[model samples]
Target: MRYKGTKAGAIVVAAVTGSVVLAGCGDGSGSQVEGGGASPSASRSADAQEQGTTEVRAAYEKTAEAESARMTIKMNLAAAGKRITSDGEGVLDLATGDSVMTITAQDKTIEQRVVDQVLYQKVPGQNAPSGKPWIKIDLEKVAGQQGLSNQQIGDPAQTAAYAKAITDKDVTKVGTENVGGVSTTHYKVSVDVSKLPGGEQMSQQLGPTLPMQVWLDDEGRLRRQQIDLTVKAPASASAKPEGSASAQQLKMSTVMQFSDFGTEVNAEAPPADQVADMTDKALQGSRQQS
Candidate 1:
């Protein structure tokens, strides 16, 4: 089966949560759909791999028709001797990158609104000097600042790119499992992650291999997915986060759960006066620091 390269929306969670601008996730019972630690002892089969690829590809296509969905992302990782975790929930406008997502990390929770590449964030208790409750962030600016691609950071084609990453090999069906309580087929998958849409950045930092597992329903909708990756920390002027006390690698596990497909999500931005342009704020902040 061929995995079609379509425009898929993406919202990369780890970096969004880890930025010094703020900071920096779970698995299942319901979320078991996201961890890469499940080891399947079943024999490998070329036929299984091909079939799994077909199913995964179909799931991507099927979900694309879903105009909106309820999305949950849970991430856990270790970087620079510190462990980071976060949980994000919200509605996504599948056709566009527009979304209203709230991320909860430790004791802080921040809500973000997106209209295409323009992002507005509401960091609780922290407002701009102007006291605006919402700040607009230019994803393009953040991408360049962080050395990330729009897709890696999350673009409209994010899901499509993620689905396109699944190739037709090295896939093993682990049997049937319930994802989000729905009975589905479970498969453990590995890919040349460097080949994924935004995988080049991941490859640059972590090496080329990424392990993933997914649970797909008969309707070809992906109910749950998990990935695990570990990469060494490169000694660099910028890679080391400030205040880090230990030389450490970045270890991350991600689980994304999707449900309530076709749900109508009316996510809108706040009033203009309540919004502060973060693109200008970040640049201004940089200028001042310099």
Candidate 2:
């Protein structure tokens, strides 16, 4: 299939999130924030909140230090009265921001590799037009038009954005829990979308703040993370004729599980002869149509 205009950019962004954001699914079961006056009891609650924020920040920093790790991602997206789920597994190098992952959805598996901030995908039969096995997308070029940066397209880079969102007033400790058989402490925080990379575009659909949950192991390593996004369709979308199945709202839940920290990951770009530049092709197609 051919990717055109913003639609193509959105698809690429979604694929990039599979590796960058790295989240998991979780029920919104957490300690609720209590109202606080200037009383002594309120002071104690404030202290606890500060401590929780510190702990969560530490885990975020420590996890960013990991050299490499094996990761698996599951995303459930419901839109227009239809649901689609995608699963992916890969190894990510936190230091270099390189990754190799295979994602499967709707009975089709796509091989994706990120090298030096550029993304390469190999789709079965989709490359027949170019007689190539791989399609390449330059994140830098796309970022110029899409309001995304290559620095925010990798696992580690996006992880860094969390640092900007964590604040003592908004972080809450949700007690201890076990993830994947390992004991961990759960923390819930509201992420300010404006602080994220390319967040301005998303804020329109996802709102200003996004609720996120994270589980950290004893050593302050991130074991799991989750985010759920719900978006209401614009009025223009419902402009279809009567009895159409246009979606009123879209919901997307993502879960990312982390394992085997410090693992070795080797990813490289595909051979030039076997790779096609999708950006160039799209430009050429646009010129011809014009």
lDDT of each: 0.56, 0.62
Give per-model TM-scores.
Answer: 0.69, 0.72
Scored by lDDT, model 1 comes in at: 0.56
Q: All candidates: CA RMSD in angstroms?
A: 10.1, 6.9
Candidate 2 clashes between residue pairs 3 or more apart in a chain or in different chains: 23-255, 23-256, 24-225, 24-255, 24-256
Which candidate gets the maximum lDDT versus the true structure? 2
After aligning candidate 2 to the native by TM-score, how far in Å is the CA of 83 from where it should be? 4.5
